[model samples]
Target: MKYSISWLLLLLFLPFAASAQTENPVYDEIAPFNEGLAAVRVGNQWGFINENAQMVIDFRDDLVWNQDADTSIPGVLGIRYPQFKNGRCMIQKLKVNNIPFYGFIDTSGEIVIQPEYLNITEFDQENAIGIYVREMYQGQNEIKLDIVEYIFTEVVVNINGEIVWPIMEREHALTAKRRYEVPKLRAKLIGKDLLEFKTEDNKWSVKKLNLNL
Candidate 1:
């Protein structure tokens, strides 16, 4: 029996072809893999793809406004990047009236928190994230349509989505912010036990995150 040269070449390349199918499959858009999976966009829908290139989470399930009648003809170009920290990733969706809201989803693709908040940061190992609600304010410049500000209203929440701190008063929150000489107080590390806040004062302070103040 004589084996043709083409047949021999095909056999030699089959293993590589099979590997290509399962390894680093190219995607139109991809995000950095967090934990074991990363968010990927197929046209307009978003879903999670695992390291092995498996579609662990269906894109349709978590996509924002994909099935809505009011979705733009072009659709949203991209959803927020998915970065799984402490097994929870932030996801976005449209409100019943067609407004955008944010929420959290677990690695299993379950909605851990319903999409209701206006803005959210990724939860840390402490199960804490900064939740901001949009507030319109009067600005010194009247030429602009309106001035927008974020009150650290619900500053922190545990992984279970329970408020660690009660709702912060807008006036009080602003007053407290002014105390720090720093122009901006940035929270670098938000651990459960404590948070490290650094101020433009060029000084760092460890404040108990659940301060009643």
Candidate 2:
């Protein structure tokens, strides 16, 4: 009977012993874990740490900042910081004009894609929509007016940063879409290796990407 009681007590105390071995580092802010990694901020720089509290990614100041104001909005991009989705995390750099360009990094902190895309969605089913922007100025001689226009071209990109297809909204028309409300036109994975996009006719068109590569 004494042996059985001792075994029961050991089982109950095992949990407390294991919990005591966990590490607790002093961080300015600690975010919830995503993909087995958590974002930790020390001072103004941010880095990623594993579940064991080991810093897997070094701290950097150039990550895309999360706006605290957007946290209250529903369905809006209110992530406290960029997170790893599908073994990749988003990073940003400033262009010559101080515009922000985004790219991705692997869990090992390697830059898989250069920071050249104007905007990109997180990897969904090993595919994402990468948008490139071009600015144009149209001047009207008669009215003596000049207006700025932004042309946005979205492409279906794979996890390896390869453009599988340059999305065409209309048949035989290579014209890109406007920057107004770009999120609504992002490509979505509807099924296995199938991408669904809204066409210019307000109809949904499904395209199959070469996922084998």
Candidate 3:
């Protein structure tokens, strides 16, 4: 019997493919793939693996968890592992006071944004708006810390973690003619490199954005 070239190639590669499948470490849980990678857990540590079953991100015990998760149900995972979106993932670091700081990592598991912002939104195309806060501390008790005065500004950041522009305040973004309010602190990219916004007169305005996305 004569076998086709494709069949012969498959026969030659079958053992290697089976070996690769068997080489994957036993994971406590594996989440569905998001953007070509999936979150895998061993004990309490979590990491990511690509479609090829190669561990791209090393397992770390410090990855954030879902504080309010109820894992009693079957097939439910408690930990809130980072998932890639638009080729970037959000990671959280806890401060000394247990406060959460947010940052972003590229697809290669390299830190693209340092965990410094008070809060940040997921990347919309090539830009994301984050809240930068300056707080005046009041005091801290056994339960929580008191922050009396918080001065925050919403700023726009590129994929390289550089602050390119400060988003206009909501009041300023509101149109005088129609009283149109900006929905939220978000930047939605249009086409290739355009940002659309509502002007003071309630007219649509489009500006060209040169970003490092």
Candidate 4:
């Protein structure tokens, strides 16, 4: 009976000891409750820690920030970042091993989806909208005058990376325009009538399509 009692006490104390060791660094900042995760900055790197002060996600990238305004987490174009949806946090990042690509990963650090396209947005209702740009090139000195074609594709990916449905494809163009003495290319999503693409060109014309559609 005494051995059993001691075993129970040890089990109870083990959890507390583990919790104490997992305390988040004071300098590490946590996001609001809505953000679902906290971003802690250690030295020159940044990572994520759960509410229990446990290091759920380790520091890996040079710039780690959140995109949610309420929580002020790091947001970058290519790096994978966590986002809150339906009270649950989802992580999305650009996976470009070859050409520019994008994909999504779940909270448990599993690649639920594989990287395949040029760009991807965070999943909403198991659906994500993406855009692909094909650059138009000219010869030698004329290459500078080349244009870019932007295509929009919407896909539905389940938590297991299964494609449930494929949506229609839309295309748009980008033209050069002068902004503050600098030439920039602006794209408009054709059917949806949204401004979706932006780059430097030199003159104004509708050539690139936005992805919001």
- Among these predicted structures, which one has the highest TM-score? 2
Candidate 1's TM-score reads 0.56
Candidates sorted on TM-score, descending: 2, 1, 3, 4
Give each model a TM-score: 0.56, 0.65, 0.55, 0.43
Best by lDDT: 2
Give the count of colliding residue pairs in each prediction.
Answer: 0, 0, 0, 16
lDDT of 2 by residue, 1-213 (tens): 999999999999999877776555678888889999998898878899998888999999866557573643211143467578888888888662465667889999999977766657677777777675545787665778766555667777777888777785322111333322214334566665787877777788888877667
Lowest summed lDDT across 10 adjacent residues in model 3 is found at 70-79
Cα lDDT of candidate 3 equals 0.65
Q: What lDDT is reached at residue 86 by model 2?
A: 84
Local distance difference test scores for all models: 0.58, 0.70, 0.65, 0.44
State residue 176's C-alpha deviation in candidate 3, in Å: 38
Poorly placed runs, candidate 4 (over 4 Å): 1-24, 27-29, 34-36, 42-45, 62-81, 84-100, 132-152, 170-213
| Residue 75 Cα positional deviation in candidate 1, in Å, after optimal superposition | 23
How are the candidates ranked when ordered by lDDT, highest leading?
2, 3, 1, 4
> Against the correct fold, how does model 4 do in TM-score?
0.43
| lDDT accuracy of residue 100 in candidate 2 | 64
Model 1, runs deviating above 4 Å:
1-25, 61-80, 132-152, 170-190, 195-206, 210-213
73-148 per-residue lDDT for model 1 (tens digits): 2112222455577887767775423545567778788888776554445666645544344456867566766565
- Candidate 2 segments whose C-alpha is farther than 4 A from its true place: 1-23, 69-78, 133-152, 169-185
At residue 136, give the lDDT of candidate 3: 63
Give the lDDT of residue 25 in candidate 2: 62
lDDT of 3 by residue, 1-213 (tens): 356887999999999989877896789888889989998888877899999988999987645545464444111122355567688777777652555666778877788888766556666677766655545677876688664544555667777887786655442321233453223433334544576655657667777766543
